[model samples]
Target: MSSAPIAAAPAHILELARRVLEIEAEAVRALADRLGDDFIAAVGLVLASRGRVIVSGVGKSGHIGRKFAATLASTGTPAYFVHAAEAAHGDLGMITADDVLIALSYSGSGEELLKIVPLIKRQGARLIAITGNPDSPLAREADVHLDGAIREEACPLNLAPTASTTAALALSDALAVALLDARGFGADDFARSHPGGALGRRLLTHVSDVMRSGPAVPRVAETALLADALMEMTRAGMGMTAIIGDGDGDRIIGIYTDGDLRRSLASGCNFSTARVADVMSRGPKTIHPEALAVEAAEMMERLRISQLLVADREGRLVGALNHHDLMLAKVI
Candidate 1:
């Protein structure tokens, strides 16, 4: 049976979505031009804070406050959200005298927030306000005020908190990133904070984690014929073989790759007669087994090589890896 044809959405619906995006985008852009000393002071306060940061607000601002606190906490700063309404009902006890309070209000006059501002100040905590109306009571009472004003909401009725919420969220993210930079927070630090994600796995996974060790490592002695080395590489399916020195199978003297084979054939060298020591490239690039897989990828790219012999601190070959190994680990 044929399914009934679905009705097409009205063109006005798509137009409205575009208009909303345009207004929200403009609001976020305007925030860049408005930033100055107060924004810097807010960052400084958080950086110098001896205790955690307390973010609070009411209604839509309260929702934005929760996200703001989460972003700060995730990006090297310690912060948490405290709902303005809940603060009046004894949740305020969660706030400490050594903490910094960041209050959010579009009008700078949220009754619930205003009710607790003086009380919070009495506790010896510094107050930072994010509001649209600089002249409002919240801004007037705050130690520092960061402007979150926008021209208008994207809502046609000018009532919904569309553009305002977007502006507040953007400003909060900017603050978090600025603090992240000031604290020298790096990808490794971020990965540590998110150990369950793919990025974390890529950053934390070591060369040893994905390397082929023991019999799987394609290795041949330096005195071995090129044909024997080629056979070892073929058996291992690594496309390359390590030429080890006489002392032990661990000392990597050189390496032979398919590229080297092509070049040797072009030079009219007979693989069947040549020793691996004569054809292998000396001083092959290597990496430590303890090193991150991403670092191995970097070495491969910079040296224009496809494989690396994993070595110990003494330069003894412990394992082997190639671009394919990195690809399998999703580190490429």
Candidate 2:
């Protein structure tokens, strides 16, 4: 007997996936259209509250709820996820009367969550529910109900939660961004929340905080020979030296770099005889010591110079910063 041929997956599978995406997109669009006074009221309530936002849910909704909580917390609003199952098992203590509870349940009938509704109510925590069914227990009991109903699941079997979860995730993002805008959250606030990341370093780190200062600075008098300035640059290991005059007490006159040395030597200039003021590139690009390291990096790139002189407000040589400093600080 010939073996039965293995069945290939139907082409309808791709169509089903597209349909799921379309349905979920519609759900999110509906949410955007429905965002009238109720959404504003919800945001106002959460903003005026002195306590944190307690996001709770069960099953697939619970996973999305955790992400929402994390996004909210990172964007300036203090928030955390609480498993409804655990909340009924004494985790309810984490919620205070001043907190706002955002509960998620696609069917609006998660048993674990339903079991804790009364407890949350008794704690005086206001409830905001996202549900597919308006009449479901969770929705009926909430102070404000957000409809997350979808036409259908992406799953062919129609059993797995797919489109509903995507809609909920999108709504969560919208809520977090709205709150972030409402709070006037800026890059510095975000940097404070993410101190270990590159963006955080770029926003929070100042040039004064990382630039070499005091004795570490490579500097020479304007009257010094090019050879002497090169020696200072080498000894200091900064690849460049600032040439300053006596006026205004350390007024920068020029800057000498290793590149300048090569060009001078190639041109047959007498390095030993050429004064730093004569051989050096005059009016070198300088940055305020108080400027951001990232700004300093931009200056270096734009000027095509690897080293920059850090100066005071009055143009006095204060310190030095080079590409290496930016590399060490990870600003590059």
Best by lDDT: 1
lDDT agreement of model 2 with the native: 0.88
lDDT of 1 by residue, 1-332 (tens): 75998665789789889999999999999999999999999989888889999999998998999999998887788999999999999999988888999999999988999999999999999999999999999999999999999999999999999999999999988988999999999988888877777888888999999999999999988889999998998999988999889777479889999999899889999888999899889998899999999999999999998889998988788999999989988887
Write one digit per residue (lDDT tens) for candidate 2, span 1-332. Answer: 86998665687767767887777777678777767766777788789889999999988999999999999999999999999999988899999999999999999998998999999899898999988898999999999888778777766777898888998998888888999999999998999999889998897788897799888998889888888888898889988888889454988888888898888889999877888888888898888977888999999999888988888888888888889989999989
TM-score of each: 0.84, 0.89
Residue-level error in angstroms, candidate 2, position 131 = 1.0
Number of backbone clashes in candidate 2: 0
Taking every candidate in turn, the Cα RMSD to the unseen true structure, in Å, is: 4.2, 3.4
Any runs in candidate 2 off by more than 4 Å, and if so which?
1-23, 214-216, 246-251
Supply the global lDDT for candidate 1.
0.92
